[model samples]
Target: MSGTSEGQGPAGVAVPGSIRPSVTERHNFGRTASELRDYRAAFNAAQLAMAVVDHRGLVISANEALAALLGTRPTELRDRYAADLIDLASDARTWHAYREVLRGRRSRFRCTRRLKHPDGRALWAEVTVSPVPESGTVLLSVADISDRRELRARLRHLQMHDPVTRLPNRTLFFERLTAALESSPYDQGSTGRIGLCYLDLDGFKAVNDTLGHRVGDRLLAAVATRLAECADAGGPGHGGGHLVARLGGDEFAILVEDSTGTEQLADLARSVLAALQEPFDLAGQRLSVSASIGVVERAVSGTSATGLMQAADTTLYWAKEDGKSRWTLFDPERNAHRMTRQALSSMLRPAVERGEFTLEYQPLVGMADGVTRGVEALVRWNHPQFGTLTPNRFVAIAEEDGSIVQLGQWVLRTACRQARQWQLDHPDVPPLFVSVNVAVRQVWDSDLVADVAEILAETGLPAHLLQLELTESAVMGSAGRPLQALQALSDMGVHIAIDDFGTGYSNLAYLSRLPVSVLKLDGTFVRGFQDEAHANPADETIVQALVELAHRLGLTVTAECVETSGQASRLRRIGCDTGQGWLYSRAVGPDRIAEMLGAGPRPQAAAASG
Candidate 1:
């Protein structure tokens, strides 16, 4: 049989006479033998285990790779049943599956199996077994995937936990939430609901700025632990379960499943607030932080994961805005208003370009002579959809979106042009100074002096007639270059007034050094004069002191919010040089302002009293 050729066989050999094998058939057998030898060599060299088992499930041959994989020698493994290697007590089903392959019911099998190595180390392998009927042997291959498994575990850790706080992130929180929502003893009604407590750490930015980020990170980790403890205190029995997560940057979220009502959620929010009230010692420095919480409980109906998240976000903003260290619930009306504001803010730049904005001038009256000294240029938006909108509605949004730079430029040019027109029309009225408010970002980002100089030059208006009103905070916050910029504007003869005084960190020493000529007292101080008789004497004394101080520094004092003749009289007695508010007139159009100036200082007691 060994010497048999494709076309002839040995004389004594019992050959099948009807079959005639060709040269290709003989070459095919040789190629098959060579390929099998190569496969066996490669398999023996592999780090994974390899073996060939007979039809009776007895190992016919084993490779060095298999011996190394099993931590034993190849000779000891010969003729052993493959099933004997696996820990049968833990994986009986896998052995049965291998038997099915031997029974011809299955051609292949794959499973994760555990085996004890010769060194007694427990090992895991992903095994594959395939039947080779032509050879009457079954092939088995195994690869150790422990490192890959560990890598997957590490990736899961990073995805589910916060790096800084070591707290569960939103992914793990939502996973737990879904499990709790699906668990037994769900909410009582058809409309089952869950509650979320969203919290933002108040004054955390101050801590991060004062201390370094390392201390801040340590403080956040400590806070996370405290929050977890609080959640554990109100665990499963109270409602269902409470899961806390760090939702990035001083913000945290808590998921309370099967909440009976908002009351339970409120209690949890208060507990978290109380938990955070305790001071944290980080890097030998003691720091205190407070959290503002937003609680929302919703029936599973009409709610989705994204909607719930958005609701929490909106409520969180409300919590921060309505004074920190407090909690607010989601309100449909408030959310609608926020949506509208968002829409308006998004549309503001396009609105300006489309000519939706118009200027209205409010008279700044001289208290001594009852004459309209100047008109403060105020911006009003005539929205196509929402109608007339005031500066209070969109100015801050503009500043935040960086649209204020363009808006400020528009205001400057418009006011200067109008002031130039007013000067031409009312030559009798002492050259009206059109005051426009300047935003801090605009001052920082733009060449404000050049902008003003260009506007004055283009409009042919005197620089002194165009006053720029900068808030006290905005002025004082300016650094070296911004200070120089203000000085440059002052050098160009553009009068600068500190608007909304007494509201910020009022460093009178710094105030005396700014290149400003006018001090506009904030309305709060003027409103105090209305109730001075019943109010603290110190209030009146402070107003008098401010007036004396401004006069002593050669600065003009303008009293704001002179609503009535009585308030105006008190302001005049305090020696306030000018008054601006509802007393003389509300802000009117440029045409109306021209008419008022032409009407020859209409005598009004409120204006004269100041």
Candidate 2:
């Protein structure tokens, strides 16, 4: 090897020969010539491939190990550009770093590079370059890391895949999804939008339970095969393929980068659903299955992986709710409504505790005399954020979260106390009964009989004057605990009125056996009797039959939603015992009820005026 005697230091300044270190001082540590020969022999025999390269980036000398590693003779490597020999100029960054080391501007340069041996086998090599002391030359070292690299690759494959189905798992799915979202808009061939289809097999748990996991595993593998095929066929417009991943259990996801639009995602979702519809002939079990898919597609600029996934999950739930075996697209309006419902549901228990609820009473008047018979208690929520909300807005939410039990207790206690107050305040007028609506969950979840007994006792109100109204569907199926509760409450003299009657099972025979005392006809039947000329005889006939049946079963009938005088007159002619609706007055405060009780029957125009 030959080189200039003048060397360049790390500052890129040339060092004169007089100041440069001697070969004996740097390489042999001031040893004799024979020891220097021994050092050369050791360098040649060393296992790590090594080379000497001048400031010009030309290889001056190569050790036997380097020659063997490169599958070339030492003579062939001599005078070759070190950068070309190890493919250092493959990328701009690595090339610039190598130049920095050659120009004495960098202390050292190290990087991993893929090298092709003369025998045509690829090997991953860790290449490092450091300056040789005072020689204006650099010592280059190469270590074989292919084995380590291969091991890491294998471990990553196993970590990112499902063992049973051999598909990408949730970890890899999230990784790819995050990468897609994070990709720069300026990237070559980049698309500004993305899409995903998230789905799960319907009735998969039943399959696992009935057929055992072994069979279920086979079915999953079969499903995965079909899903992969669907992904391939439904790839993005850029020819970049869709990524199909199993997100645990029967749930899977297909992500499309550079997505075209919603139509593309919808097509993919439909294809997946269609593919899964076919029967899986696993081990002669012949299992059939379907999937509910949620398809979401939008510009990637404003969304994150988590937000996109949440939208997809919500859409998928809607698909299942609309009935499985279908795909649902994400609708912003529907999502907003869902968000509102969720907001309401989350605040339900707190609202009850905050005393955000109040009661209004609608008059249930006698059909024959048009006189006030009793007042039905209707609950209202004065939401701080949403203003006033009727029961329809939040009752189902409370029922789902079991907050209805607490809310119902409040309504019961408040209504009984108010009824007792009204009874005492208006001793001259007939005592007005306050009827409260009860949810079926209130009966099953709480000691309904005990709750009512306690409230009536605490409020000093007679049970006979406090009517408990339940929907027809709830009471018709009464048995076990519910049936016992109803009988006990009835025996205590509290009237059991079936609200929205003739809309449910309308089990007339069952009604005769239960302890029910009153039937409130559904509004749909009364809406038909809005005016005399428009009255449908069929509706009147159904109402009259239901009324006659109730009368025979020793129960009174209350016509609900009586909106006009004509309807009230017909209801009176039909012998409907009591009427409840806006024809008298919309549900109002206790003061209005007191006014009604003091003023005789309400005039025809009085309700309209209110």
Candidate 3:
């Protein structure tokens, strides 16, 4: 038995030279078989999905992990093809490479592939297929990567957009602008230029002050979307590709590429203005907002992003300075002038602190008797460099910067002090009132009643002798608290006159209800009386009606700009209580006012002639 034994060979035929194995060899073979079985069992329990496929692409075996991944039992997957479980639409190239590995054409193949589960959901898998030529099988290992992909997508979204407005923020805006500028030069055969429009909302601060920041934020978001729509509408077919972006709070920008010339850019600017003219509906409240656009169009060759942005910023300031809610193109000359103004306005506060301002009084007279009844206080700035600047030159800047409140208080105190001095100089003359113009900010920011009372007390002037002139719109625009403040001052015996009456859409009913003592007809209305017969009868009728209504309400009526006696007589006949203009005398200093008061009332003919 130990000598020889027949062994089965190829094709199940017995071989004569085959020798039988000894007992030691048989025991060694059994031990080796047990080790192989243990290894296969451990491989079947792996956490990752593992599968063995034959060179023909048929799955020979699958582990529990692979069966769970495919939503099937190991027995069902054992004889199935690996391709049947994968999503074919994801990528056919990856599966082809896997097949090549199974065919022994490649040693290993690794890729990310998407698979369809039995539950009809997509699963992402990082798959590695390796060939085992001797075993005629391929080993496949897979790991899930779906969560990582979603996380990366979310991170990208946050980086490119604004948190508050959900629009492309400054970083993304610059990236897009850089790409646009780069492409613009190539498209134009090396001659094309890019145009940029920068916009800042006007009166946004007022809205934030009157409403809350919540409303302001919502308003900004709404504006961003509207601007985006405008950019979309101005695409290449109609105009060109335009990109809009939010450059932080209340500021937005647009990049218009491949512009032919400034005309096209200007048209784009106008379009933006027109688009923003529509009212914004926020939190159930209708709010009106306007934007000032600064446009710069230039060739892409020499301009840097910073330079373009700076030019746009400079132009935007010009738009704001030249009266907001308008557009201004880049002009070297205009920018220089604006720079000068900016310099002056920047120096104004220090100038004020250095005592650069003075007050000038213009006399308002009674048309019938030619006597000075009051004077309108006007501000004059004796700038060290730009000397003797009037209120027209700097008042707007002061108002915008919120320095008008301090300047207004100074004017009141100065005018009251001057009036007190004038009264001391002339005891026998008629009582004179000093009318100081009040700004809307002065009313809203300060305790106006207390300020007036303090000024009068400090100057030893009677409350009735100081008239506070407020614009008609300013008076009408007051809410519950501000209106109460005005009424409180009136109750304290201070006279309140509505200045520029015809300019605003004044409600006569509300006017009568307000504690106002006088209504000054606007100069525009009085100028109409220059040609009474030729002028619109409606003007005369309106003036007459205003006068009658004022009298009925026990308010005095003062007609402004009576340049002719005919006009004076017409106003007098129309029952205008008083008139002020060149028909009497121009504004004078305290000395002239004293001399005029001492001379007494001139004759009616002489007064009219003067």
Task: Give the candidate number with the greatest lDDT.
Answer: 2
Model 3 lDDT per residue over 368-449, tens place:
6656678888888888777788777888788778788888888899999999988888765556899989988887788888
TM-score of 3: 0.56
| lDDT of all predictions | 0.83, 0.90, 0.82
- Who is ahead in TM-score, 1 or 3? 1
Tens digits of per-residue lDDT, candidate 2, 111-170, equal 999998778999999999999888899999999999999999999999999999999999
Q: How far is candidate 2 from the true structure (C-alpha RMSD, Å)?
A: 6.1
Lowest lDDT block of 10, candidate 3: 9-18
After superposition, candidate 2 runs with Cα above 4 Å error: 1-31, 45-47, 65-73, 103-106, 186-188, 237-240, 600-610
Q: What is the lDDT of residue 67 in candidate 1?
A: 86
Estimate, for each residue in 294-376, the C-alpha lDDT of model 1 and write its tens digit: 88998765566778888988898899999989889999998988899899889989987998899999999988777787899
